[model samples]
Target: MGLITPIGFFSIVQKPSDRTHDTLTVRARMRGDLAALK
Candidate 1:
């Protein structure tokens, strides 16, 4: 039960972190494209 609890918590934490990382990467890419266009 203890091990499973940590695993579940980690899985929940990982999802949002992954999403934020992807959003930041996409924003960075868009900014780079705009800069290149200029």
Candidate 2:
């Protein structure tokens, strides 16, 4: 039970970290494209 709780917490934390990373990557690419357009 103790181990499972920590693992579950880690998974929850990891999920958002992954999403934020992906969002940053996409935003960076979009910013680069916009700069090129100008």
Candidate 3:
């Protein structure tokens, strides 16, 4: 899932499963003004 903010972005991954492991992770990123998308 993803979200947009005034100066950045947010992302999250829940219950990610690999061949031998299940991991939980949270990620974030920065972005420019997405005037067109708004």
Candidate 4:
């Protein structure tokens, strides 16, 4: 719990939106790859 708090704080300070953008980008890539496979 203690370690997680620091990491969470760092993320919010460094780039709060980074995680959401990354998740969307990865989801898009996965969809493209699946479409290609089919």
Per-residue lDDT over 1-38 for candidate 3, one digit per residue giving the tens place of the 0 to 100 score = 88775655766576536324666544565333333234
lDDT at 28 for candidate 4?
Answer: 22
Error of 4 at 8 (Å): 31
- For residue 12, model 3's alpha carbon misses the true position, in angstroms, by 1.4
State how far residue 9 of model 4 sits from its true place (Å): 32
lDDT of all predictions, in order shown? Answer: 0.33, 0.33, 0.54, 0.33
- In the range 1-38, model 1's lDDT, one tens digit per residue, is 11233213111133466786664222223344435434
lDDT per residue for candidate 4 within 6-30, as digits (tens), equals 2132111224576666532122233
Q: Which model scores highest in TM-score?
A: 3
Clashing pairs in 4: none
Q: lDDT, candidate 1, residue 1?
A: 12
Candidate 2 lDDT over residue span 9-30, tens digit each: 1111334667766642222233
Screening candidate 3 with a backbone cut-off below 3 angstroms (N, C-alpha, C), the clashing residue pairs are: none
TM-score of each: 0.23, 0.23, 0.37, 0.23
Off by over 4 Å in 1: 1-29
Each prediction's Cα RMSD? Answer: 15.8, 16.1, 8.1, 12.8
Please identify which of the two predictions, 2 or 3, would achieve the higher lDDT against the true structure: 3
User: Candidate 3 — which residues are off by over 4 angstroms?
Assistant: 17-24, 30-38
Per-structure clash totals for the candidates: 0, 0, 0, 0
List candidate 2 segments past 4 Å from native. Answer: 1-29
